[model samples]
Target: MFDLDRWLEIFQTINKNKLRTLLAGFTVTLGILIFTVLFGMGNGLKNTFYTFFQDDAQNTIFIYPGFATKPFKGFKENRRIEFKNEDLALLEEKFGDRIEFTTARISKGTTVKYKSEYGNYTVRAVHPEHQYLEKTIIDRGRFINENDIEKDTRVATIGRLVEKDLFGNENAVGKYFTLNKIVYRVVGVFSDEGGDREERNIYTPVSTTQLIYKNTDKIDQINLSYDMAIGANGARRLSRDIKKVLKDKHNIAPSDRNGIYVESVIEDLEQNLQLANVLQIIVFWIGLGTLFAGVIGISNIMVYIVKERTKELGIRKALGAKPSTVIGMILQETMVITMIFGYIGLLIGNFVLNSMGNKLEDWFITNPNVSQGTIIFATVILILSGLIAGYIPARRAARVKPIVALRDE
Candidate 1:
C-alpha cells in the first residue's frame, strides 16, 4: 500500500533539502540525456551506410579494363585493354553457374532533343540485363527486351529526369527522341535510386550503340550480379577467378595490376557494415558508462541525505519503526526523483534527435532514433539505480543505535 502519511513526511524532507534533491535529479537527467543522444547518433551512422549502398545491388560486381603494365606472350607493355561483346559471352559460358546476370556498358555523351526541348545527357548502350544490374525501375513501360538486342533496334529507355527535362510532363514511352541527330523511339520510362544523375541518363541497346558510335564491338565496362548463395568468401574467390580468366584471354601478365580491375560490391559492403557495427558497440559502452556514473552520483548523494537524517531515522526506529519501513521510505523518495528527472531527459533527448532531421546528413547521420525497447530498458535501469542507491545508505542508517545517532552533530 499506499502510505499517505509516510509520503507526506518524505515530501517535507525533500522540501527542506531542495538543493540536495535537485543535484541528485540533475545527475540522473544528464546521464540519460547523454546516453539517449549517443545511442541515437550511432543508429544514424548505421543508416547512412545502408542508404549509400542501396543505390546499387549489393551482390553486384563491376569489371573495368585498363592499360597493361607488363608484357606477356606476344603482347607488349602499355597495351590498352578493351572489353567487347565477346568478353560478356565468355563470362556467361565460363562461369554461368556462379553468374546471375551480365551486361556490357558503352557510355557516350550526346545532346538529346524532344520536339522543341533539348538537353545534354549521358547515353548508356547496354544489353537487356543492364536494367537489373543498374536496378532500373521501369515506371511507364517495359525495359529493353531480347528482341530489341537481337535486331539492334533503335529503341531507347529514358530516365525519369530525362523525360522531365526534354518532354516536360508528357509521357515519354512510345515517343520519338533524337540522340546526336539520330532518332530513337522511347519504349520505356524508368527511375533509379541513384538520384538525379542516374535518372538523367538514357539507355539503348548495346548493339545499336556499338554500330552507331564506332561500327565496332568495343565496350567500356562489364557489370554482373553474382549468385548471392556464393557467400562473401565465395564472392571474393569468384572475383579472383574472373581476373585470372580475363587476364589470360587478353595475354596480360598474371602479376600485372593495371590490366583489369574487378570490384565486388559485397566485399566493400561487408567491410563497411562491420565498421558500423563496431561503432554502435562503442556507443553502447559509452552510454552504459554514463549510466554507471549517474548511479555512482546518486549513491553518493543518498549517503549524504541519510547522514543528514541520522537523528530523525534514530527517532523513528526508537518509536518502533521496522527496518523495511525505513528502507522503503528512502527508496520511495529516491524513485520519485529519479523517475521524474530520467523521463525528462528521455523526452528532451528524443526531441533533440527529432529536431535534427536531415541536418546531420552531411555528417552521414540519418533519422537517428532509439527504439522503444531501448527506452524501456533504460527506464528499468533508472529505477534499479534508485533502489540500489537508497538501499545501501538506508540499511546502514537502520543499523545505527538511537543513542549513537542522537549524539552526532
Candidate 2:
C-alpha cells in the first residue's frame, strides 16, 4: 500500500541528513560512471575490429606460393614455388560443388597515364569473383565480367583514387588510360573499405593482364572460400581439404609446410570474436568491482544510520511497529539514493559519449552508445544494492528493546 505517512517520514529523514545522503549517493554515481565509460570504450574496440574485416568475406582464404625451405620428394631446398591459372581451373573442376567462390590475382607496379597526368599505381588481373571477394563498391560503370576475360578486352576497372588523379573530376568510364604503354579504356570506378593503399590499384580481366604482361597462365595468388554462413569451423575444414589436394598436385611432401602458404580469413575472424567476448567480460568485471565498492560503502552508512536511529526504532517497536515495516523503511531510503545517483550517472555518461561522436569518427569506432538493456540492468542492480545494504541494519533495528534503546545515550 502507498503510505503517505511513511513517505513523509522518509523525506523528513533525508532532509535531516542531506550531506550524509549526498556523500553516499556520490559514491554510487562514480561507480556507475566508470562502468558506463568502460563499456563504451569496449564497444569502440569491437567496432574497430569489425570495420577492419569488413572488406572481405569472413570465411575467405588466401593461398600464396612460398620458396621451399626444406627439400621435398628429393627436390633441392630453396626452390621457388609458383601458381598458374591451371591450378585455379583444376581446383574449380574438382571442388565445384563445395567451392562457393574463387579468384586468381597477379599485381604489378606500373605507370598509369592520361595525357598530361601520370601516377604510380598497381595493376591487378583478376576474375569476376574478385569483385565479391574484395567487397567492392562501384561508383560508376561495371566491374570485370566473364566476357571481358574470355575476349581479353583492353578494358579496366580503376579505383576511385586512380580516377581522381588520372582524370580529375571528369567521368572516367569510357575514357582511355595507358598502363605500361598500352591503352585500356576505364570501364568502372571502384572503391573499398581497405583505405588508400587499396584505392591506388587498377583492376582488369586476368586474361588481358596475363597476355599484356607476357606472363600467360601465371598468377601470384588464389583466394578461395567455402561459405561465411557456415562459420569458421566449416571454412577451416574446407581449406584443409583444399590445401591437402594442392600439396599433392605440387609435388610438395606431406610434411613440407613452406611449399605453399595458406592464410585463413576465418581464423582471423574467430580470433576477433574470441577477443571481443573476453573484452566484455573484463570490462564488466572491472566495472562491477568499482560499483561493488559503492555498495559496501552504502552498507556501512546504513549500519551507522541504524545505530543513530536505534532509540526511535525501539520507541516505534514499543508502539506496535512491525519488523517488516522497519525493514521496508530502511530499504526505501537506500533505494531512493541508488535510483537518483544511478540515473544521474547514466544520463551524464550518454551525454558525454554522444557529444564526443564527431571527434571519435573513423573506421576505428562508430556509434558508441549504452543500450536500454544496460540501463535496465543497472537499475536492477541498484534495487539489489538497496536490499542488500539495508538488510542487516534493518534486522538489528527490529531486535531493539524499548527499555535498553531508551536507556542508551
Candidate 2 Cα misplacement greater than 4 A, ranges: 228-231, 358-366
The best candidate by lDDT is 1
C-alpha root-mean-square deviation, candidate 1: 2.7
Clashing pairs in 2: none
- lDDT (CA) for every model shown? 0.90, 0.84
Clashing pairs in 1: none
* Tens-digit lDDT string for candidate 2 (227-246): 55666676677777777878
Give the Cα error of residue 3 in candidate 1, in Å.
6.7
lDDT of 1: 0.90
